[model samples]
Every structure is written in C-alpha cells, then in structure tokens.
Target: MQFVIDDVQKKNLTGKAVMNMSLGGSASQAVNRAIQALNNAGVVPVVAAGNENQDAGNTSPASAPNAITVGAIDARNDRKASFSNFGQSVDVFAPGVNILSVGITSNTATNTLSGTSMASPHVAGLAAYLMGLEGLNTVKAVTDRILALSDASGATVQQNTAGTTNRIANNGQL
Candidate 1:
C-alpha cells in the first residue's frame, strides 16, 4: 500500500500532507514508507495513536517515530479514555465524541464513539485550517503549531506504579 501511495505521491503536483489514519497490525512498514514519502515530498503524515488500552509502546504506526500520534479524549476532557493507549509516543489528544455523525442507527445524530482513530481526523482538519489561516508552507511548522495550540491543561501523564511497573519492568514476572 505504501509503495502504491508513494508512487502516486511522486506524481502529485499539488503537494499536500499525506495523512494515514489506519492503526494497529504490522503496518509499520507502510507508515515508514508514508513518512519517507511525506519527507521526500516535504509534507506531513499524521497518524492515530490507536484505541488499544495498552501502553503506547504496543500501538503500531502510532508508536512509529516522525508521524504525529493522536489520542482520544472524552467530553469533559479530564483523563485518557479507558480504551485510549497512553505513553510518551502519544503526540497529543483531541475531541473524539460525542460527535455528530452517521451512527449505527442509520440516523445522523449525536453518538459517542471513542478511539484515537476518531481523534486523528480532528487534528488533520485543524492542520488544514491552520495552513489556510496562517499561510503555512512547511509541514514541520504546521505540526509544531498544532502541538503548541493543543490544550495540555487536560492532558494526563501516566506514572509508573510499584507492582504494575515492577511486573512490566521485570519481564512480566510478579
């Protein structure tokens, strides 16, 4: 998939950010390829941090360096969602719901769905808006600006606890 996208990107004349929302699985190669393509084309590749509740280290693509990894935050924006993976890899958090979109009920209404997948689009949209507003030309500047504007007041940092940390630290031994 990366090969195909890279091929298309090489032919692209407009030169826009090559955003990838797919997360999980062994798609690291594709991400690396996209990142390389973006770099070669002088664009940004934004990615989702993933919905797995495990440590950020466990999430693929999001764990990949260079790409912006986004996490999902609830309505109150207090703590990380139980389903949201957390770690140093997570670049930022964004509103994931209760968003108004097509729901399972077949009606366009307010529905609460939580995942880093959902959060990534918010950042991507912001990037597009900022690029238009600030006349931004470089991908790095746009990414940096978005990070700077992020509401870190509600962001939470995970701390290593005694037993849990020891188990993970000691190779899963109790």
Candidate 2:
C-alpha cells in the first residue's frame, strides 16, 4: 500500500489517482495511517466495507476515515447484501451480488461472484470516469460530484444502517 502511495507521490499524480482497496482485516492504525497518507496526496482511496456483516468500524482500511468506504448491495432489490459490513463507516452501497466480471483464467474468461470487493470497483470506476468526464481533478471535487449525482430515490437501500448513506453509485444517469 505504501509502495502505491509512494509511486503516486513520486510520479506527481496527486489529484488524478484513484485507488481500489478491496481487502481488509482487523483494524490497524498503521494501515489507516497509510490510507490517510494516500488521501493527503489527493488520491481517492475507495475501500471495501468488508464481508463480515458487522459494523465496518472494526475493519482496517475500511475504517480509515479518509477513504470512500463502500458497502455491498443486491442489484435486484437495492438492499444491503447479506454479507456486507455496515454502520457509519460505510459511505455508500453498490451492486455486489452475483456480478458478472472478467476472470484470470484466460483472455476470454468470465465469472460471476459477489462481495464488497466487487462493489468497491464500481464506485472507483465511477470516480475515475467522472474525473475525466466532468473535468473534476481534485479528490474533493470528484467526491462531491459523485454524491451529488447519486440516485438516492430509486437506489436507496432498504434497512440500511442508521448512519450509512442510502445512495448508490450513479454514473450521471438517473
């Protein structure tokens, strides 16, 4: 993680970098600090909220305050996924149930899986895309635009955690 942070800094890609952190474990101040450093470099740290079905506050990078912590949701019902971590640490929800994605087996390989890991990339991609599409160069500008463009009405998760936002990632489409 620090390596990636250093690379971004050394390459001077401050406001144009978006990191997708799909892994997490027990809370670590070290990891949190690194993520904070990433944020300090003006990089968007998109982290998974974990699959523990518990408060994401107990997870490491997910608990990092500077990250855009993402939780998983079922695309069918717009409800939190059964295994997704929740609570205040989770910023937003995205499609994570049985998602179709490319696999590592071969060039033409494809697979379907589900997890908060899958969800984080959805928002990460949106963040990077919005950055170029709307000329949003800073982390704050991209974050603000994402939240502003999110679909709160239709994609609101049912039974979301009390402090978690009900918004889902939207690529400028309502």
Candidate 3:
C-alpha cells in the first residue's frame, strides 16, 4: 500500500488516485500500519469486507481505521449474498454476483466474478468519480462523499447485534 501511494505521490497523481485493495485477512500490526500510511499519504484504502459470512472486524484491512470495507449483494435480487461477510466493519454493500469486467488477458476480454472483491471495485470507482467531480483533495473527503451518497434503501445486509446498519452501494446516488 505504501509503495503504491509513494508511486502515485511521485507521479503527482495523488489527487487523482484512489487506492482500493480487495483482499485482507486476520488483523495485524503491519496491515494497520500500511493503512495508516496510505491515509497519511492522502490515499483512501478501500478493501473487501470478506466473503466468509463472518464478522469483517476480524479481517486486517477491514479492521483498519479509515479503511472503506465493502461487502457483497446479489444484483439479481438486490439482497445480501449469503456468503458475504458482515458486522460493524462493513462500510457498504455493492452488487457483486455476476458482475462483468475486464478479464486478465486483454482489454477486449471480459468475464464475471463474484464476492466482496467484486463489490469493492464498484464503490472504489464511484468514489473516484465523485472525487473528480467534487475536486476532493483528501482520502477523508472522497470517502465522505461516497458514504454520504450511499443508500439504505434496498439494503439486505444482516444487522449486527449492535443494531447498526451498513448501507448498500447506490450508483443512482451518483
């Protein structure tokens, strides 16, 4: 994360770059430190909330403060994916099932993938687009817009014991 942020900074693209990492594991010092460094460098670290169907608070980047952790929902029914991780750590849920995107081979190639990994990209792209429009200059600024624009409607995230709701991603808000 630091390396990416450093490279973006070196290229003077820090203001235009928004970092999103769609992977994580059990929380650790190194991961938290990296997230902090990314934040310090003005890069929003968007990450997957996981697909283990467990509390995302247990995951590394998801557990890291200031990280935007995304969960998954099925586009077919606008419902939470049974396999998506939840809990207070999840910042938002986005369409993940059967999402189409570029494949590994070439720009013309495309494929479908699922899980929170697929969901995070939607939020990351929206946040980046809003940043460009709003002239957002910091990670917090960009993330704030993304969160503020989120919709609780059609939400399918299972509520945590604490009763807080993790909103669903709404491209319509864009």
Best candidate, lDDT:
2
lDDT of each: 0.59, 0.88, 0.78
Candidate 2 residue pairs in clash (backbone atoms < 3 Å): none
Q: Please, what are the lDDT tens digits per residue for candidate 1 over residues 1-174? A: 355456656767223554656466444666566566665565566677677666665656776667677766664643455676667767776655465545676665556566777777777777767777777757778767766555323334233211111101000111
Give candidate 1's error at residue 169 in angstroms.
32
Strongest candidate by TM-score: 2
Residue-level lDDT of model 2, residues 16-94, one tens digit each, is 8899999999999999999888888888999999999999999989999889899999999888898999988888888
Task: Give the per-residue lDDT of model 3 (tens digit) for 38-78.
Answer: 88887878888888888888888887878888888887776
Worst 10 residues of 2 by lDDT: 146-155
TM-score rank order: 2, 3, 1
Where model 1 places Cα greater than 4 Å from the true spot, the runs are 1-15, 18-22, 26-30, 104-111, 151-174
Q: List the residue pairs that clash in candidate 3.
A: none
Residue 46, candidate 2: alpha-carbon lDDT: 95
Error of 1 at 34 (Å): 3.1
What does candidate 1 score in Cα RMSD to the true structure? Answer: 8.9
